[model samples]
Target: MASFKDFNLSRKVQDAINDMGFEEPSPIQASCIPLVLEGKEVIGQAQTGTGKTAAFGVPIVERAGTDRRVQALVLTPTRELAIQVAGEFRKIAKHKRVRSLPIYGGQSIVHQIRALQQGVQIVIGTPGRVLDHIRRGTLKLNSVQMVVLDEADEMLDMGFIEDIESILKETPDDRQTLLFSATFPSEVRRLSARYMKKPEHVTVNRGEMTVPLTDQVYYKVLERSKLESLCRIVDSEEVSLGIIFCRTKRGVDELVEALLARGYLVDGLHGDLSQAQRDRVMKRFRTSDIELLVATDVAARGIDVDNVTHVINYDLPQDPESYVHRIGRTGRAGKKGLAISLATPREFKLLKQIERETGAKMEAREVPSLADVAERQAEVWRNRIIEAIQGGSLGHFRAILGNVIDEYDPVDVACAALKIASAGELEKREEEDYNFGDTGAKPGMVRFFINVGRNANISPSDLVRTISEEAGVPGQTIGKIDIFDRFTFVEVEQESAPFVYEALRKSRINGSRVNLEPAKPRARR
Candidate 1:
């Protein structure tokens, strides 16, 4: 289809899509949206990050109404994906009167029950949690009209196939079913064959299995200091014509502005830009006028640049396919390239998920120290001076640099002059929060000591709920939690450490006042 208009979707959904800045449909979205909207069972073979969520989400939201009796049920393999899928439904149904809820393990069943009682139009959850809710009689699937098995292969791998079968049997036999998976093993095929009714099969294969010429790695850093880390890396590496990916349009614009302020030649691309505007940015980027392009995933598609030396993930991608697509922007035309991702400790699970899905091992590295940055900066400057000398005549700057060139290599003189001009701004961010002192957590994680555990009549769910609700962060970001008789130790990503600390400290939990602080690493055994 040429445009989203070809789908003939309702005005509200189309508007929401427009607001999302998506000018075109992804291959999966284009193929499955129409059939799913027609109320047909579909077996869509595609990788994640192909906008499959919207393909199904938009149609589901359009088909369901304000009845609020769970018209649609989406089964996922993990709590993280449940939250993510549910969030997508909420976003797509923002213009409608639909209500969606995500129920999964590590949460309060009582709370989920209460939400269900209040009337939910859509339910998204893991198989185990869904079956639990079903057996407990707190959830009713009799009224469900559409059932979606997202990441079918993942659910099978996690050994949730039995739970999935149990939950599916509870739904009405006539309901529309949609199954999406990256691969179709015999087990998945059998599952679909039994559940779906003459399903239409659509497979969208990925482009050349992850290019062999790319070197993929990630750096762990605190969120607040991420910008500074990016600058240091930029100065430290030879990024000739690169692309830095952000998860959202706002992120793209922010990073573009930040880098531009730091004297980097960069430009931004996102859905918000007009076609003319996007064309101009691409023109500049291809012509090498812009050293870096800060872009969102949706806006960076169909971009084939051969000399992009680096592709930086300013924010971790939502799935592995996005990681592959972003990194593929570099390492084209037989040239070697680097793919770097800036990850927070809280995002360990997602990083692992990507690695599992793509079979790409990303080496975790620490952010460069100032000394390292300085050393790299000198080398980069020397190369720039040499390139300039080889490409142009000396008449342009000989008069100004002639005296210094007499005693020093022209490269050294140029480097010293540029350093003085910039005043080392790229290496500086004095107020940036850089560390979580001795939290005994993993390399990129922070361990917290909380006062109030079992003795305080608290459950891990309560702590998760309090921290997630009070701090206004997603509950999934809360990492491995340990509860004790009178205290607890919770590990959070380093980026969320300070927020979780300030938001939960001195707050009341189960009517008992609480104390929370970073804990020192325990003595090694």
Candidate 2:
């Protein structure tokens, strides 16, 4: 590992780095910082947590040198990454008087326009939002001397290649271009060939993509039963701090709602959220105020939390690269972490693809049973009791203990006290098995009816997607999506039912208005 000072960065930039407590440069940073400082075009292949932000950010800040105009432009695939990179730029340029602004959607364009008008030296923005400003004549890249594409492969995956090309064409031809991606896919190569001029390539930890300290596992589950299995596993495992990755923004929202209904301390992060909401959610998550963060791939790109104990793939990612990124959220800083995926039989091949691509063996795990949950709860309780006893503060309870022992045998008294102490947890564990109504649904769920079914040419998968998108209820929490001619019945958790109904009540499915309401139970003679 090389020290940050070895790069011979500007004194102010070095001061900022010292303030940030970055003693040593990461592999990517060590390899790329000096090249970037030399104004060389570079292509970096590295994962999210590889400290690439500072690698390019340091050089950009030091070299841009107090330019009031937009001297540097960083393009990111998602608004979250744009904001994150902008924050990093500001931190690295702290000693310097450079102003970096993050321009992305879900924030008022007028706000960004005002910032741009106020003379920002560095601009970090998502491709779409950057192009929007370009079209609006608010962002000018004519003076931009350095451009960076953070997570280049993710931008390619998001169909931002054209937008990137358009944005690049607008920048100064002599500007330095740095492209950083986890994987150098063919698209990335093509992109570099077209835009970059003899870029130096750097690959860090190329052969080892997955973190060694993470315990990777997958559970075989049916599509509809995934929610039940996820809940069971979460309850049994007692995940202290974790992230659940969903494939889409809708999936993220649905999972968040479903988890909330099930009484999990969770929040959602996705493109649909406002910048303020996203910031609030992230702040809470970092502080451990939110135990589980349900997020889409793009939304989670900027998460750098180290205390995350588990990463659950609520929905299997589309590619192996995404799988690596999702699991990389945990097992950070050489700490042991857990990465678990729930895959339907149909999606099992995708899981295999991830294993082959990442060179990681994912152990198969069974869905946690009720007894397993009970055992885990008991173990947790036992640990708490042992810790309390070891603290030697039970003297205050001696009088009560004596009274109980006088009435009953000592063993009986101990057993009674243990039962009383564990009563609430026992009740919660038992409630996990509570089925709702005649639909054989679990507790916290309700069956609902929606018009526009089979005649609308919709399948169960389509219905699940539609409901998830329209109702903001996760597909897993949606139970028994029965499609019939001109009518469909679906079960959603009771806590999310109102949201589902309100969202779908006036929504259209396949060009037909959907009338969604709670299903009326049939009368028995």
Candidate 3:
């Protein structure tokens, strides 16, 4: 529909939509909202960034009574998304005074308890924390009229299917259930079959293909070196606009802070920001005030900037499908774009798998040097100066500049002027507490190093979990782990170097202390 008016929505919501600059409903919103408002069980197959939140949020806001009894529940895979969906509901229901609460991990349980005690009308949360509330009698779902499983496929991938089933059991049997996923994998349909009541099938095919114009590339680097390398590459490359995708909120915040410190025009976008903050960041990014946008994958969804020159995967995606979506953000509307991923030796295979799936070969590029970054900064200054000269703006500032030139060498004065014009304030922060040798993993990889090799009898999962627990890193981040009879090498974050070195310094793997250290770089085959 052209506008929310056609949907017969409340005047307040309509006004809010107009103010939010949403002139027309997206395909998923158009189809699913109608069914959901009709109190029908619905299954929506669409991408993460395709306005699914608004589709579900609108109906939930319009239908749920203002009784403040938690009439609606939205389940998301990540804590960031939990915060996001709840925020969206809160906004749409603003004029109605709907109370929505987001409950997730890594936050104070006491605070969540207090919020739940206030009797929210809508509750959005991750499955685990939601279950925690349910068990503690903090979240009563008897009044829940609608249950939405946002990013159902991701939850399933995360092995939360059982948790979802348990949560569904707690909801009212006749509740309107809406499940949305990017792709309808068999397991998703299987869950729909079991839980949903003949759900109305609505699929918005993202067309099984990534953008053709995006040039995909990857570099094999140590885990610790990823961020440093990213800074160098972004500084050197002629990227007018870019997005750096990380896996978590901490990553987004840390990277944004780091980029800001390095004198790059960058900002962070994730679930933690208030609506006002999100709007400000997006405004800056869209206006080209910020050159780099660092965000978690979920939060960066539905960002439709057309001039994005590059998409850097600071962290490799959990799957090949996600790789497609992450890179898809760049090459849009027939514009040539670049997609780069920082891969460790183990994750390189995963990159190969993505290439096979996309039927596109990725070029491996050398990391840009510090000298290259300085050259790029100079070039950018040169272009700005030329633009200023071509526009004939020198008349106003010529006298001041001429006096400065008379006091100093013309070349030195000109260079100082360019530095002042082009200099950016980048932010950096102290790195997180990660060990280099905690998992005995090699520096710059997600994998753990093991002492046992063919002779000692060790395997991947053992090392993965060992390091995963010790270093607080995920198994997914662990990269190619090589086992040797005398020693083993694992790839992990470069920042984790000291930790890993110290952790494994006296630790034993496969019943033996191993020599674990950063490995020598190898040429790609």
Q: Evaluated with lDDT, which candidate comes out highest?
A: 2
Q: Candidate 3, residues 137-220: lDDT per residue as tens digits? A: 998999999999988888887789999999999998889899988767899989999988888988775333455677888776
Predicted candidate 1 versus true structure: per-residue lDDT over 1-525, tens digit per residue: 789988888898888788776788877788899899888889987644456788899899988888879899999875656777887787888788899999987788999999999999999998888999999999999999999999888788668889988998999989999998877789999999888999999877544345667888988665666798899888788788999999899989888988888889999999798757887898899899999999987677546566999999889999886687678677765679899987654455577788888888888776787878876766666677679779988795788777778989977886677778657743444445646688777877889998778989888898888777665457877888999898899988876676676666667788899898888889999
Tell me, by TM-score, which candidate is best: 2
TM-score per candidate: 0.48, 0.71, 0.60
Give the range where candidate 3 is weakest over 10 consecutive residues by summed lDDT: 424-433
Candidate 1 or 3, higher lDDT? Answer: 1
In candidate 2, the residue pairs with backbone N, CA or C atoms under 3 Å apart (3 or more residues apart, or in different chains) clash, namely: 254-474, 444-494
Worst 10 residues of 2 by lDDT: 428-437
What tens digits encode model 2's per-residue C-alpha lDDT throughout 1-525? 568878887899999999988889877888898899888999998877667888899998888766579999999887767877888888998999989999988898989899899899999998999999999999998999999999889888889999999999999899999999988889999999999999999887634457667889988765656788898898888588999998888888788888888778999998788778888999999899999999888778768887899999989999888888888888876678999998765566577778887888889887888778778877888898889889996887987687777878987887677888775555544434323355434566788778878888878887778766654456787776778898988888775565566556667777777777677775558
lDDT at residue 359 of model 2 (Cα atoms): 83
Name the weakest run of 10 consecutive residues (lDDT summed) in model 1. Answer: 425-434
Q: In candidate 1, which residue pairs get closer than 3 Å at backbone N, Cα or C atoms, i.e. clash?
A: 346-493
Cα error, candidate 3, residue 461 (Å): 40
